[model samples]
Target: MFCTCLCLVLAVSGGVATTTAPSLADKHNALGFRVFAHLASADRNLVFSPHGLSAVLSMAQLGAAGTTDEAMKRVMGFSLRERGASRQHRRMRRQLRAEEALRTAGAVAVERTMSVEKAYRRALSRAFGSHPLQVDFGRPERAAEVLNAWVADHTAGAVPELLAPGSLSDETRLVLLDALHFRGLWKVPFDPRLTHRGLFRGANGSATPVAMMTLTGRFNYGEFSTAGGEDYDVVELPYRGDTLSMFLASPFEADTPLSALAADLSGRGTPEWTSRLGSVRRQLSVPRFAVDSELRLKTALTDAGLANIFNVATADFSRIAAHERLCVSDVLQTVKFEVDERGTEGAAATAAITYSRMAVEELTLDGPFLFFVQHKPTGAILFMGQFNHPT
Candidate 1:
């Protein structure tokens, strides 16, 4: 179940055209960074989809009124009041759907007892590209099964069980879910023969052996410093289509906390990092890792200054339904992301090579670092996380 409020926004904003608003992308980036900062805790493997969270929350903002709406806008960094903002969101959603490497799905499961307004349903249908589902939350067991099944089906079995049994109850008025499954092959696949177990320094001063995928190729690279004067490196690894790429950043000094880099990225948009990058030949060694994370966004959202939406009484959803007092009960997001030596079947022949004479600079993520799976054209961040320890 995706955020029902987000669904409402989608429905309301579906008609907005993409070309009409360029700031929409900026709004997406700002909101993505905000969510990342809130969800990213120091010293652990963290993974979540900023786009998924923001997309759903945008919907919620559309149906929100009074202070609830204000809180969402502040946290999300985008307001429905902006001219053509709704159209821009709708266009962005369509663009995401068109990407081959990314699979994103959102849904709102409303309790059968509640009466949904027809206008709300119409807007939801437009935003999600599907109609809302009615389920009997009175039977928590059955509700869990149904919602979990929907998540599994949408994510292509990557996330089998998103909502555990008894996660829902008779009192559950709404359930919002956003599931993202991404498997993108690199444009230049890492040589499998070069992969070997290497020691990864953990955040807490421990080291563990991990499978590291290595490749030497021309990549967009840059060197930047944090506000505190710490140096770091940024590298871009393009996926098969070039439309999606993973930007990896880590501090040069081993003892530097990954949090510093994360804070910088959140404060300064990714475009700054990308702008500093230019094509350079280097040897990159990233750990072969997979992270499946389940995030309850209530705390993160609240911390990001969107507190009133969760309040039972203070929250308002008058735009969605007239008489029923509706407030967001839970906003959940599940993300499954994996990085490996996989790319297009015959991409080896098309791989670009430059400057074989220079010694390849090694960019090994031997410790904690931040990574973002981003859409190149629009600069929308599909997923972002910290690889503190990849087991």
Candidate 2:
């Protein structure tokens, strides 16, 4: 009965098109590396893992679902390239499988680009499987209304509204929408009334008092003072199932050279740090911002490692397409993010991002802010961006 119920919801709400492929485990690893590198760059200074990659990828695919394999690789690959991973390393090379191998036999390509609502429904089906979730994709204007309503429902009003309408392209051939609502009793919940304005410095040496979320719990952490003359703290916050964890790192001092810090990174020391779980007070202050971005994913994918996929002369979507002549005309992406104590309630609605984080300076906003979004199934960055503005 549960399986039947789940499939019905998946079919109705999720726009997941049926394909011959079983599950995409190999692609997950390739995608993971992309996300990790992009967020960990010296300029952006963010950290992400495979789980963050999945969240963002699922959200993107939720809105824009045609030929996701290539776009997914580019987003993930760009992310990995940004962090300092070698572009031609053997490990990276292995992820580059022959394009012909990715196709399913006798697959007939469909030209109907899935709508964001359809893509989002597909994502929900993938995440919740058969669990019921509300999803809809129609006219561009209706997108905002449907998304906002979904957010309100899932977040339990934490995110009262999601889209402001026309947030998507009126002429957009497709749209993907993912509405995720999570309600968890914090291991140590913060007293809402106890919230106080605290100073958060930025790269420009300015300071603003922001509300900081507070909690305490036993967490897995890695504390280190790098030889390259930087000291930072890496804290891992585990979600309920233990299948996912959020890794947050902040420099010990505001002025610790970030570029050098990133240069000294070696995945080698990370495993050793896994044994350092302990209880401690956590002061978390995440800012709230909304951003929208539109991108030509087809080009971006070519720049990464999937050039063959777009090369009409060498393209191989044959598993889905009838002739080798057709190539991806356009790959569009749109995303939205909102963070608060209730544990991240927004989706990457469109293809862009508007992010605000604690400044690099402890007391002033004269340094940089860096972060990443990773996937747990395979560590990767679905999106990576940074801002140097003081405002």
Candidate 3:
């Protein structure tokens, strides 16, 4: 089926005039960076994009995008508060409070900015048109071609021919397509020759052999013991100015029933810990796999207090010309990740920016995984989540 062409109508009427360039906050940029980072790790075989989300927020702040100085403060404040709301409910509450404060003070002007972002997204849609997912035994080969083409096109061919369109179904179209895609390589590559198998403890306390990629280099890192009955390790992988981290934790060997540790770790709060680095070289192994899943991010985002966007009746995006109604149509994110001895590499692309790269090697995690994407300059948790399974 042909996708709709959500093109931009440049023809303008005299009443509503559009502004040239509006001020934008570094905070929004930083926040966008972090969100993209975490999605990159979740899977290495698909594209994880963050355009739609970033555009909406940026657009809302167009005219009154806070000054860089003020933006930095707000950005920092968000990060500090995030440390406090480790749980979903608390996190949502915290964001709502911040957004309300910005609105109450008449400081954050994002409406105009959002308008521009929306138009840009529409242009992207038309430039690289996409087809809805469809599957049928009779057209299995064609289905694979369709899926592979979308993935390659979105990722700019970095992750070539990754998905088998044949695996999709007409019902797949029903699933929300919101996705975040990233692609990059490690600052330090692991020796592919040194790769070896090591034991990885599963959620059920069973041990299995996993291919671990190893590396030896000075890395920014943190350490801590969680009240959740686990010892934690935080390693930072810095990019051109952005940095993302992986937090690995597991029940202290002496801790009681392993299941009990899992329960404790699930609670949310500031991830209590310490930071440091040392001269260390070790063998590491990780599974080579890709994850492709569709999420109804609308619910999660709405549950996080962004109901106005989903509820067209309440959405306040009137700044885009005289149009009185605008709400998020849908949020589609797809992420692909892969890791081996040479180093970790993956990509996360969304319909928003089209594509991004996040690659790292010489990476290893021997415990529970908790990762966060942060604007290296501002410690904002654009996105945060934990992975307990190998998808």
Tens digit per residue, CA lDDT, model 3, 70-139: 3423432232113222243233323322431111000111122113335433322332221223233234
Give the runs in model 3 whose Cα sits over 4 Å from its true position. Answer: 1-52, 60-154, 158-183, 204-206, 226-230, 237-290, 349-364, 372-385
Q: Write the per-residue lDDT of candidate 2 for residues 1-391, one digit (tens) a residue.
A: 0000000001111111223331243344445434334333333323222322333343333222235445544554332222222222223223311211111010011113422233334334444232222233335456546545554554345444434454443323322233332222223434566555656655445575556554444444455666665776655544444433445555667666454434333332222333454444444443332223333344444455545433334433232222213233333333333334544322332222210022222211123433333223333233333322223
> Across residues 19-114, which tens digit of lDDT does each residue of candidate 1 receive?
444367667777767767777776777776666666667656666788888787777777754566656666776787687766666777777777
Candidate 1 wrongly placed segments (more than 4 Å): 1-22, 343-360
Local lDDT at 275 for model 3: 27
What TM-score would each prediction reach against the true structure?
Answer: 0.85, 0.50, 0.49
- What is the alpha-carbon lDDT for the whole of candidate 1? 0.67
Candidate 2 wrong stretches, greater than 4 Å: 1-109, 112-185, 216-218, 225-229, 238-244, 256-277, 280-303, 329-332, 350-391
Q: Which run of 10 residues does model 1 get worst, by summed lDDT?
A: 347-356
Residue 237 alpha-carbon offset, candidate 3, angstroms: 4.2
The candidate maximizing lDDT is 1
